[model samples]
Target: MNGNQKTEPTINRKTARELELIQFKSGYEDGTIIAQQQHMNSVLGAISFAFFLALFSAGPDAFSKPALIVSEISFSASLVSNILLFFFYKTVSGKKDLEYIWDFEQTSYAEIFKTIALFAPIIGTFSLIFHYSTLAFIFSAFIAVVGFATFLLAKNQISLRDSLLSEYRLSLLYAGRDEDYFTLKKHEFKQKPSAEELKINKYDYSICNQKKELIGVVTLHHQAVVGDIIEIADSEPLTVLRIIHNERATKLICKEYTEDTSAID
Candidate 1:
């Protein structure tokens, strides 16, 4: 049915909580890294432009045609990278809500900038090395190595997060529905609920099956018998806790009530 025919009976609450927390933490780190990179981009862009201006101020003979070409390309590429980073950051950060699903979409754009940041330097450096001295080559080489390493690491993390998200979504899709519960109106009281009875003052109910034992609190709207099974708007069978005909909704005080499954049966 509805593609959930093979859905699992239930998910382990502890495991689910841990996974959600891990994703949240990773998302936070991703945001941090993006902010850091944005600042770096601005600084790098200014430096690149300054270098370009300096080359012109040196006059035509300052560097050979080939050298000038290489330097110009490197500086321009660096400048463009900075511009792209600015736009990327602006777009992603503009959104106020940061849901888990939205993480993938945001990170994908950031990843593109990361790729450009990684390659632009390498290409620029290699080009410059041909025109400049051995020192240039050494510097470019170092930047290339670092950029490549950063790219690889970021790629791996993105892949891992994507896999985790996929698993989580699939689990959510296939999760099976268990029994639900509801409360009844106090006015409909067939017999006055004893003072010792755990009354459902709010929408929350302490449901059980046949025996009077605690199951879990289920939120619902409407009135029904305390021990009887009733179907709510969702069509799920829920055990009734306490009935309420016309009462003001009060702050929910969820005190666990004990009952056995056999009580309902």
Candidate 2:
């Protein structure tokens, strides 16, 4: 009976250890996925920011007014979407429980935002090209198609090569990492924008209620004309009462909008 009891406890211990290892493996896989997603977001954000900066630096004369405006709006949207997704991933990964991390499924909104981040820059580029010259645009389009096809062909070849490699060799390639290799290092989330980093040249809109009470401030990253109705988060739609422009920033003074507001001369 004592021998049987000893054996039973040993089995229980083994089972517990196995379960712990399974949990660890699951967490590591999830963490790896999150890490990959974060990296993708970083790349998209950088591309979007680069395009936005290029457009801004080119001033108003690089392209036709309408084309330039569309490109700027598209790139800005992409940049904002990428930034939001990066923060979403960071928030999910910051949870203490690994199970929570595994349970976290990205929403459809995230997928939509990611799609925008992926294609908005391309759209913006094409818009500018089309505005400049049809022949140049067509040539650029052809080159883009060829480049994408080549990338796919190269990727497929690499995948086929990797498939033929033995599991032992693959394992060896992944081995010899430090203890924290699978662990994701914590990232410091910046809470506030630095004084030097402030975008003073951008337009910011301030929303107020009917009583002239301040509601909130928003940066639309685009031009806001007077009498335009704009939607601010967690608030009713506001109408642009006036636009105040200065050397540093442009402010759109807004108030709660109604149908009558538009009728007013």
Candidate 3:
């Protein structure tokens, strides 16, 4: 034995599965944000076209001095909102590093577009009321649909922002550690099974097992020693299958192993 076994391993099958699920959830949120941003671009395009169509359809009589001022103000606001949406789409569509993404999320200007987009229908309805047009309700309803779409886009972006922030915090845990862990270039296997032993450093782990092979990565919250086997909270026993060391961090590759085994046949 490498050392006296004291405690059990903390990572097991169930906790590994939960970590995988968390990664999937974060990925889904990111995809939803991108899809919604694209959809907003298309929706805003249609809304812009309709805005101009309604303004022109009103004809010369539609713009008395007072009416003209109201239309100009509302249309200008809508135009500015469209410009903001365009920039937002550009940022999301282009390839961005983590810093750029963080910066974009921090800006308050994007919220202005969201607010304008959400309230556009109200402005359109007001304009129609002044014109006394026959299709006033229809135009107002169309703008309302666009506004609601914008609302959904904004909500998804908020979710994505939160998830990215969470991911960034996780990344920081390994961002600056450069000399703590060393990578294993080769692994040795024994002709027959031997006692299990695990060596844990600050960020790296070395598992000693005669009949062992490379397996997938696992996470743990607590520490363990050579002969000690630990279990995650309410999970099965964690049997260390292998170990992987990289510059970013050390991963314990594990699987359940209860019986002694010979080397590869």
Candidate 4:
């Protein structure tokens, strides 16, 4: 037995379809969330740019120097973060094919820029409003703390949901063979079973020639009946000659069907 040739659990056609549907739904939801976040970032970028322009036009005397500088820096940071995130989303989304879902959580750049973009505007606005009075500034700081805590809570919830969905999709991917169906076709002939002692299971099949010469064993999940033509591993197409059933299991007797073999048959 080949050490690498491990058998996979068989999934019926109906169960496979169900797994496929579940995978599709999970991908769709993930894509939707990504799109929503992209849209939110775009909107926030525009708002931050507008505020930056307004502050710049207000001149040095319109607000205290410290307040003015901090506000300008905050808005600029938010704007830059949003722009970087926008391009990141575009580049990542464009490179990926439509076959797989976008996993945003996998990229730390995305999370960092998104968080900065989301909260920078709030910080800038509060700093500008409460700049003049110490008491007002302290109150604004308390409110900002509460808001930041709320945002963290919401972010945690979203992360938890994404983690669960990712795990579920991974389980479904492993449970079904759809992802590796074509890869299985390239399996090499491993072991040949003896004619006197043949074994038939869900994944392993024994093939023999008409004279009971043991050919090679192939892994097949479906039942092989007489007259069914199947290409075993790297061999030519072989026609099933007969099926022998004993108390244990059934054995397949096959022969290569070529022009010469056809004439002989």
Candidate 5:
């Protein structure tokens, strides 16, 4: 039989709400130290590989004595960038900011720096093309950008941790089929949400305060039925509550409904 002969069970696509919930849950869990280190090594190796490719493209004349200085300069800059990335990974590894590394709100230090480094090949290639090749400038720029991004990522992540530890952020997120219910609409200072039923169908679905300030979340008291209009509230998001009801209308909640101020902002 052909490889395609095997049959597989059908799988339903994840709803926005389901995907959001999965992300939320994953954030709460932490990755092992080994996994974090492996991530760093992978990035460093990739950057080094790209640099080699750049050097190869810089032409045979690169080996000539006059061009030696420029080639070395490019290599040095790429080296610095890689070194900085290594430190960034090490910093994260030691500090254990797995949450921030994987956070939607934050970009990984490795990614930003590695990206900055990834541009090094362009600089080297250009240097080789020009008669007065100065690979120094390009490599220097790469090093500077990646270095700065690494510093900023580290600083921001540390600052975020300190701030969160000091006080709760009081945030809420909702996403499903309705802008009113699933997509986060608004928030207020006072955590004010009582058991209210947003009746889309005749069913008296309920909503309550989900977040305790730091990060409020909500769930169906029972397995969410197909037509339940659940309202959610968070103290920081102050007044807006997500009103989820049905599947056919999830997109309505993405941007336009978020602009309306019917819920608290």
Candidate 6:
């Protein structure tokens, strides 16, 4: 879907079914895995900040020092990676509600990370070997920290790509994440599963209710790991937010059904 496209109240079942086929919620919560991602991101930010502090504190003396080949290479790699990030951000998801994600998604940021990771250690080793280096220990330290940060980021991206998170979709019927609406089969819902029957932790899942009647299913981000439902709403994000206030967030998301939806699958 386009970044500016209007979203549907109920997503089609196609995406949901496809995701299920791949066993989306079988093993672990995506959020659990994403926590590690956040850790690497925090470290990367720290390195950038530390490097600048070192450069500023030393001033002209820092520049008078000779630059190492690895330092030059790392700088070049950083520049290219940043440029790629700019282009990718402008292309994939431009000016949208989930724009906040663009901050973590630094575009070819993954690639930049890998480049730095691959080169930083080499540079560090070279610096230690050629200890008669032109730059001060602070400069070498900055490169070491930045390189380690990049390595961590590269590892995270390579293994965990949350393809289905924060994506715009058709509706709950087609929800792949927790907090989507499911079309209730009259026979099964007749039992009126208790709230506990519906709540599944470690992974997102929701039971749909209308006027206290079970009519559908919805997968909720009770955790809000990715973009929020508010980002995908048509009338108002509050329309959905109001759901959490009125009932359980999932209970508020109504399922699709005809008045005579009595048949069971």
- lDDT of each structure? 0.58, 0.70, 0.55, 0.72, 0.49, 0.43
Q: List the pairs of residues colliding in candidate 4.
A: none
Q: After aligning candidate 4 to the native by TM-score, how far in Å is the CA of 43 from where it should be? A: 2.0
Please give each candidate's TM-score.
Answer: 0.38, 0.42, 0.39, 0.40, 0.27, 0.26
- Best-matching candidate per lDDT: 4
Q: After aligning candidate 6 to the native by TM-score, how far in Å is the CA of 95 from where it should be?
A: 19
Worst 10 residues of 6 by lDDT: 233-242
RMSD of 4: 19.1
Candidate of highest TM-score? 2
Candidate 5 structure quality by residue, lDDT tens digits, 1-265: 6887955433367766777777665633434433544565456546556655566564765566455446446655665776655565556643356565556224576567666565664555455544353466567667879999999999999999867643432322222335543222344235533343222113233333333222334443343443334344622222324445564321111111123476766
**Per-residue alpha-carbon lDDT of candidate 6 for residues 1-265, written as tens digits (9 for 90 to 100):** 6999975443464565666643533212323223333444344434433443444454554455444344434434434443443444444433352334434533686656646644553453454334355466667778879999999998888556433332332344465533442232222326553475356433233332345454334455344322234222233231222143334343444333233456654
Error of 2 at 92 (Å): 2.6
Between candidates 2 and 6, which one is better according to TM-score? 2
Model 5 regions more than 4 Å off: 1-73, 94-96, 103-112, 121-265
lDDT of 4 at 163: 86
lDDT by residue (1-265, candidate 1, tens digit) is 5885764443564466677777766645446545666687787777777776766764774465676677777777778888776656656663353343246535877568667765665565466565557787778778878999999999999999878866755555566411211121222338654343334332555444435444444655443455556443433465454543335432221223445688785
Model 1: weakest 10-residue lDDT segment is 177-186
Cand. 6 TM to true fold: 0.26
lDDT of 6 at 124: 35
Compose the digit string of candidate 2's lDDT tens values, residues 113-132: 67887788778878777766
Q: How would you encode candidate 3's per-residue C-alpha lDDT over 179-202 as one tens digit per residue?
A: 222221122233542232122222
TM-score of 5: 0.27
lDDT of candidate 5 vs native? 0.49
Ten-residue segment with the worst summed lDDT in candidate 4? 94-103
Q: Number of clashing residue pairs in every model?
A: 25, 0, 6, 0, 16, 17
